[model samples]
Target: MKKFVLVGVVAVCVIIAALIGTRMLTPPPAELDLARSKTSVNGTYLASIEPETEPVSVGPVHNWVLTLASADSTPAAGVTIEVDGGMPDHGHGLPTEPQVSRELGDGRYLVEGVRFNMGGWWELTFQIESDVGSDSVTFNLML
Candidate 1:
């Protein structure tokens, strides 16, 4: 009877551990209704970077969720915007690569996951290319 009880307890523990591990491995789904600029890239539009808050020093990791708005105040959809300069000087350390966000097809771009390995201001002058003329804008982000 003692041996059977101990084995039962171990089995329960193993099952509980498996369930906990599965839950931990699961990642939260990406938000579909994400925040975005209320503007699209147009000729009469002015592109600028507005920091949501003051930059703080976190580890070597930080993320930025940016939205490209148009002059008419709508999310810029299906538009490819490029940042030339990187980091906080132009934007946040130009993460060595331009963060590409998937277009939700509703005139909004979603830059879901951005990881900055350093802390500083990345200066980036970006240009938007589309069927319309390229619109250049500057972003100064702090990481």
Candidate 2:
């Protein structure tokens, strides 16, 4: 009985190690050009905000994918990006503070916690900071 218990413990440890190794070795998500052109100041960079969820209605959280690229079509990796926006006509900001959750590598990021309380000409702005410089772009969303 004791021998069986010891073997089980060893098996568990081995399984855990394998899982960790798999995660460490796995590559990040591929960058995709999934949305319209949203460019930074003076066309120094390009950004696109693609909604992952369809029928992006109001009052429900949504997932957005942000893709950044340089003017020369290079991936803008290892950069700090900020997201914020709201109804400009209504003079208010987003109900929740949206943020970049995952760095998918190669200028691709997963932005989560996006909720539009009441949608009517909403603007989603992205501020990017990288080695080149810092600039911002906005996406006008109509719902």
Candidate 3:
């Protein structure tokens, strides 16, 4: 009976440990803003992103339309934008190197080569440089 009790206690301890580990790897904060449109960090520009294809899924390449406007709501033309992103919780970058493949005029750019290997909390950051100034915006996505 004593041996059985000892084994049961050890099993309970292992289960507790596993539960704690899972909690530690929980998803991002509940209030993480998954907004598609937001102002740059320094208020230099307003940016928005929309996937060219709806219902983006894992293991597939996709495109996104990125639009930029001035703080006063004017189209930010001829701006240089650098695209980057990663899964914050997983500490891994995008599976593909996405870039501004084309300029669609009227402050819209075609960003291609965006891919998500696994679904989680991902952050897409845009480093934008315009005639006015330079700033960045990060958009959060949950998949």
Q: How many residue-pair clashes does candidate 2 contain?
A: 0
Which is the better candidate, 1 or 3, if ranked by lDDT?
A: 3
lDDT of each: 0.49, 0.81, 0.92
Task: Give lDDT: candidate 1, residue 24.
Answer: 46
Task: Give lDDT tens digits, candidate 1, residues 14-64.
Answer: 999988776544433333222222222345444434332335343333334
Clashes of each: 24, 0, 0
Best of the candidates, lDDT: 3
Candidate 1, 23: how far from true, in Å? 49
Q: Which lDDT tens digits does candidate 2 get at residues 1-143?
A: 99999999999999999887776444333342223566786686888777897878998898898999988889998888899988656667999999999889888999999999874567788888998679988877766
| Residues forming the 10-long window of minimal summed lDDT in candidate 2 | 26-35
Candidate 2 Cα outliers beyond 4 Å, as residue runs: 1-35
- Candidate No. with top TM-score: 3
Candidate 3, residues 1-143, lDDT tens digits: the string is: 99999999999999999887786488799999999999999999989999999898888899999999999989999899899999877667888999998899989999999999887899999999989899999999988
Residue 94, candidate 3: alpha-carbon lDDT: 89
Ranking by TM-score: 3, 2, 1
